[model samples]
Target: MNTSLEKVLVNVVDQHGAVYTVDAMCERSNDEPNSFGDCIRCINIDDEIIKPSLDLHFHSNKTGKVFKLS
Candidate 1:
């Protein structure tokens, strides 16, 4: 798979239901073998680069399931 760094737009929703669109740097790979391709590196929020934690848990609204990020 070919890997490259890409700039992506990410939509973030706050606790107060405020949504913000931000730019993030991510490592992207071609989906030759599998579907998983992008890995987020850092998010640019208010001119600051913030590295997010990968150990967080996410709840899916459609599936109503909790998934852990590895």
Candidate 2:
């Protein structure tokens, strides 16, 4: 498959109805890397809830999980 490097953000909810966001950048180099800290990396982000306008960097500089946003 043709995999390209990308970054995405997701929403996270606490015990309450409150909302939180996170960034999940995915890249397929030698293997793949991604993040899932569920932390807000950008604001005013809204993309059909499919993709976030913002990006993620709360996780370590190097992650090893491939998170597909689509």
Candidate 3:
């Protein structure tokens, strides 16, 4: 199986509806890495919900314009 690496911004919610977001780098083979689950288990982040950021962006030094991180 080939492994892939990706950078993602994940949003996590707690039981109390409190929201927390984290930027994570993940590596996966055959299946996507469970960043949200790992974040919940390893960190103190809440697991009420997990969603990928739709507007994830990065700036390029050459273009000087913001581009999606996909």
Best by TM-score: 1
User: lDDT, candidate 1, residue 27?
Assistant: 77
| CA lDDT, every model vs. true structure | 0.55, 0.36, 0.40
Q: What TM-score should be assigned to candidate 1?
A: 0.58
lDDT of 2 at 65: 25
lDDT of 1 by residue, 1-70 (tens): 6978779887655444556677767676675443222376665666656655554323334433333322
Q: Is 1 or 2 the stronger prediction by lDDT?
A: 1
Error of 3 at 38 (Å): 10
lDDT of 3 by residue, 1-70 (tens): 5766566565544334545565555555566445433422121122222222343333334433333222
The candidate that wins on lDDT is: 1
* Candidate 2 displacement at residue 42 in angstroms: 16
Deviation in Å, model 2, residue 59 alpha carbon: 14
lDDT of 2: 0.36
lDDT of 1 at 32: 42
- Alpha carbon lDDT at 64, candidate 2: 21
